[model samples]
Target: MVRWLLVLLMFTGMADAAPPSLYSLLSQGQYQPPMQVMLQLEQNYPGVITQFDIDVQNGELIYEFNMLDPDAKTTVGFAFKASNGSLLEQKVAKLESDDLEELAAVTLMRQKQLKFSQLITLATGELDAYLTEAQLDHDLGISYLELKLLSAAGRHKLAFDIANLRPLPLLKWD
Candidate 1:
């Protein structure tokens, strides 16, 4: 019984410790705001930001953005230094018809009253999950929030509708 009690205490302590928020990280000078990086990219190629996520690549934090250029009908991917927002990599790809369809859907969904921070809080509370990565994407005329979570079960991915915050099942593994 004593051993079980100790184990429970340890688990409880772990559960009480939530991961730091993105804003806090920014305040600490760890990573630049993804929106800021996206805006810098837009100066050269005006487009709609379809995806934004922070990732560790090559042993450093990389802020990545995927933008849909309506005028060119192409998708541009940019990677920047998380700490300073310096451009590190850029790739431009031809957008497919399906991609455009999804973009339209995402644009419409974002017109609603949902905020990104609120969605992040809801996801963390629901799964007892730590946010590892986040992405905004559209599929089949639906805008979705993709979150990579770190939990006791290890890393898992989840999706939710941006407009309604409804959980979505994993359709495919990437």
Candidate 2:
């Protein structure tokens, strides 16, 4: 249900006018950059941000952050208004065993002291696409940065090997 709503919004007229870049929005002085919003969220949430997304609904832009709380064994999602970084809503879900494993992957990355914001910027700039979502996942000791992007052609799914900072094959959804 939520997926469908997000897909619908992607095709709506309002989403068509999304800014070309975070800097564009900054130059306009209309909305806070995603990085700043992310920093603020980190200060308040005190967890590892596992995912981030940009969404449009009701003609307003929203920045969504999904955080993993290792101590609490839960995942919390926060939605913030893009214009001013005002938090709109928050939802929490209990973590399962699989989630704990994922948490371990996140913890390993944390120990390495790697920053994902740089990768986000690189991926978006390289593809010349609007990044809609980014998530961290690991399998068989390999950590991947999964990204969803919208470009002139259509939606695209991309994966980057976090260890090497190399992008894998690109998958497009028309």
lDDT of 1: 0.65
Q: Each model's C-alpha lDDT?
A: 0.65, 0.73
Model 2 Cα lDDT, one tens digit per residue, 1-174: 988887898888655665455434434557787778877776767667889988766656789988887888889989999898898999999987767655865786677666567667655665666667888888777777788876656677888766676776543233
Q: What would the per-residue lDDT of candidate 1 be over residues 1-174, giving only the tens digit for each residue?
A: 988987897888963556664444534556665545555665666666666677765446677777776677788888889888888898999988768554664465446644444565665565654455766667666677777765555667878766666777654232
Question: Which whole-number lDDT from 0 to 100 does residue 168 have in model 1?
Answer: 72
Q: How well does candidate 2 match the true structure in TM-score terms?
A: 0.69
Worst lDDT window (10 residues) for model 2? 19-28
Predicted structure with the largest lDDT when compared to the true one? 2
Pairs of residues at least 3 apart in sequence or in different chains that clash in candidate 2: none
